[model samples]
Target: MTTRTDLLVVGAGPYAYAAAAYARDRGIDTHVVGIPMAFWRDQMPADMYLRSGPDWHLDANGEHTFEAFFEDRGLDPGEHDPISIGVFLDHTEWFAQRKGLAPDPRLVVDLTRPNGTFVATMADGDAIEADRVVAAPGVGYFAQRPDWHDQLPAARCTHTSDLVSFDDLAGARVAVIGGRQSAYEWAALLCDHGAERVDVVHRHDVPEFAKVSWTFVDEYVDQTLAHRGWWRHLPAEERAAIGRRFWEVGRLTLEHWLVPRLTPGVVHRHPGCAVTEAGSEGASIGLALTDGTGLEVDHVVLACGYRPDLARVPYLAGVLDRVAVTDGFPDLTEGFETTLDGLYVIGFAATRDFGPFYGFTKGCPSAARIVVDEMLR
Candidate 1:
């Protein structure tokens, strides 16, 4: 059977929720597909804390905001300064409830434009037709595995997303590859779970564990709404400077809360190092580092982070050949419309043109407003 809608959003995360809510409120028939916040619910660590605060939310209208949820629940924002994953999940659910957004919990297996309209094939062999498709796929599919990753036994190594819970890792030594926030946070969680040892190896020096301001991104997001193609039109050097600043703050600095959990003896930091060789050693995974040292751990966790690659999205396979891309990111217009006439991409995939903030919840409202405006036009 087939159903029809004016717009179909291909993800049910924060981006999808915001877009669908805004479009529906504006009198557009919209349907959202995919499990809501599946990544956060099933992939992230159980005790993870978000880098963003309550100011970030999935509300395009700004009425059902996270701060507003706090007020409704009689909860103090100060008590959740560094919001826990559970609190964020609750807020997202509350916002969705208030907006009356119940996404269809089915996977879109294939997407194609056989005729003038787009048809999305659901996993259950059902189809849905829409005037336009907005893909807001998450970064879970774009994991950046190292070159030597395949050399190690598959069972012995896993990405940070795949190994969300560290409960069974007690008494087991681990090797965490990467020095970013996720890397450090995973190491701390392992320590907290009673891991025997965790060697965090990376090519850079230890990042500073301090608080930093993210208010600078607000102006850039505001600029995006004020001017069309604002980010892409910036001078090359200016863009580079902005990227460098983001890297310095977001990547080169770790959260202060992790310091207490990442004990020196339990979580060892090996800076200026990279994994030279990896293989199985008896029951453990053996890794040789560039620092002339080696580690024999029960498991290896890769925190190399994600990159944007449209081809990795399975459902987009049918339409990917027709979609224009550069450096793995879709070429999007100021309104997030792709080269395809009725297809759009938001979230991480739109970062290349819309700016890095689009990959986070803070840009959800702006992205929803821009895309819905284009749809109406």
Candidate 2:
């Protein structure tokens, strides 16, 4: 089967949904395809709560704020404790429906640029075409596995985003790598699930919390958005240098929140040490540290970080040479449009182009507005 639309959006996560909502409001014949809330529902741990809190809503328009959604659903946002993942998903679904932005829930298996339109092939044996395409796929494809991990078998090492069930590690010794929010949250979950022991390893001496100052964050956002043309005008080397600078200066360090949760001895801290190698031994794994030390464990959960791989994006490969990526991130225009005309990428992938706030919930509305205006005009 084949269908056509004015715009094709890949991914149904927060960014994709917001883009679709904006397009709908502007009277664009937009069609989005992807698993509904796949990242939030599948990747994130069920027990984990949004670190940003429920007050930080994902609503693009003010009408669909968390407070409003709660009221419309006959629930009190204030009364809810921790703001469960299930509740957030429910609210997203409700908001999507309320805005008349329900797109067919289909996984886009392949994307190809054919002539002037984009050809999207779905897993269910259907094809769709659109004048413009926006790859708003969520963050899972870019799971960052350190090079040292190649020594270990897949069975012993896994990214935190791949954890399907904590029960699988019952009574086992586990090493939760990294010192970010996800790392701490995964450790907490492992301990709660009866793991024999959970050790959190970090390259730094202590975990850091994300700097949440509104003024500082706002300045970072402005600087990032202001340099949208940096990728286009500068050489790849220069662009990468800028990305590293921004990452060092603007990104929140690990000590901000994760350090307080460490129960002195329970969560073993190995600061200033890096994982040199990883290998599996039957059901257990061995990790060689940079400080000439080794630790044996049954499982290793990597919360190291993420990077966008354009090759995984099926449709993007055809125009891969045309779309410039800086520091493994898509280089988008101020309006979230890529170098290739009619192709836009938002969310984390577009951070280098949009600014530091691109990945946060707050940036989604502005990104949606930018794309909607460009495509609907």
Candidate 3:
């Protein structure tokens, strides 16, 4: 089957939905393809909590906010607090439906430019052609697979993004690497599910917590939300260094509530240690570390999180060869267009150009505004 449109919004995450809605509103013929919120629905644990506050969500043309969804459903909006994964997923689906968007749900296998337009082939052999292509990938495309993990068998090492359930891991000794939210959250979840023992191994001494005030968000929406806010006019290195600082405070932070649940001894911390070698050791895995410590655990969970490297995305592999990239991210214009004409990337795909904000829902509105606005011009 073949379908054609002026714009192809590829991905079902917040970024895709926002782009689709904005493009359609601007009178651009847009077709969205991909399962809506597939990452939040499939990759994330069912009981996990989003680090974003209630105010953050996949909004449609500035109309359908998560707060509005809560209000319409007669539920308390919980203004400044974090929301559960379930609620966020529901809101995403509602945003899709409300915008009259029903994604094709088929995975894009490859994308190519034969002439001026682009062709996106799906796994089911369906074809789509569009003058412009927007790749709004979710976090899984960037799941961190530590290089050292290659020494261990796949059965023993898994990233936190890949786990659907902790049921099979019950009573198994587990070690979760990284000091961020995923590390602490997964450690707590594992212990709660009765893992024999869970170790949180981190290169850092402690976890960072959310510290940005809501006022910061207000300023962001009204004025400071672009490429690096005040740092936008700065040199690339300056912008990126600022991004690194921002990341340490935001993405690397742990949810305060997780600390209490991660009781001592049950969720052990091995901070400032590095795992140098790991391999199958009978029923368990033997992990040799920089601190001269060795661990024998049934499983090693990598909560190291994701890096938005286009090369890591199988579907985008064909297109990546031509796109300009700096520091593992696409070199995008203000409109999110890649070096290749008419080809665009949003969400985390635009990180190197747009900064870290593009990866989160909070940036969706601005992303939507930029893409559609540029498309019309």
RMSD of every prediction: 0.9, 3.7, 2.4
Off by over 4 Å in 3: 79-81, 208-221, 224-232, 236-241
lDDT for predicted candidate 1 compared with the true structure: 0.92
| TM-score of candidate 2 on Cα atoms, chains taken together | 0.86
Better of 1 and 2 by TM-score: 1
Give lDDT tens digits, candidate 1, residues 1-377: 99999899999888999999999889998999999999989999879999998888877888999999999999998899789999999998998899888999999999999999999999999999999999999989898999999988887799998989898999999999999999999999998999999999999999999987788888998899899899999998998999998889999998999899997788888999999999996797888999789888999999999999999999999999889999999999888999999999999889989888887889999999999999899
Model 2: colliding residue pairs: 111-315, 207-254, 207-255, 208-254, 208-255, 208-256, 209-254, 209-255, 209-256, 209-257
Q: Provide the overall lDDT of each model, using Cα atoms, as 2-decimal numbers.
A: 0.92, 0.74, 0.79
The best candidate in terms of TM-score: 1
Candidate 3 lDDT over 1-377, as tens digits, reads 99999999889888898889878778889888888688888888998887777677665366888778888778775552557888887887887788778888888999999888899999999899999998887878788877889888787789998876999999999988888878888888897788989887888787755444433444444453444234255578867775776666675666676866786777778889978887886787988878998888999999887787788778888788789887778887777788999988888777665656666788888878877777778
Better of 2 and 3 by TM-score: 3
Candidate 2: segments with Cα more than 4 A from true spot:
208-265
- Candidate 2 RMSD to the correct structure: 3.7
Among all windows of 10 consecutive residues in model 1, the one with the lowest summed lDDT is: 53-62
- Which rank order by TM-score, best down to worst? 1, 3, 2
lDDT of 2 by residue, 174-210 (tens): 8988876677778877867778788878876564456
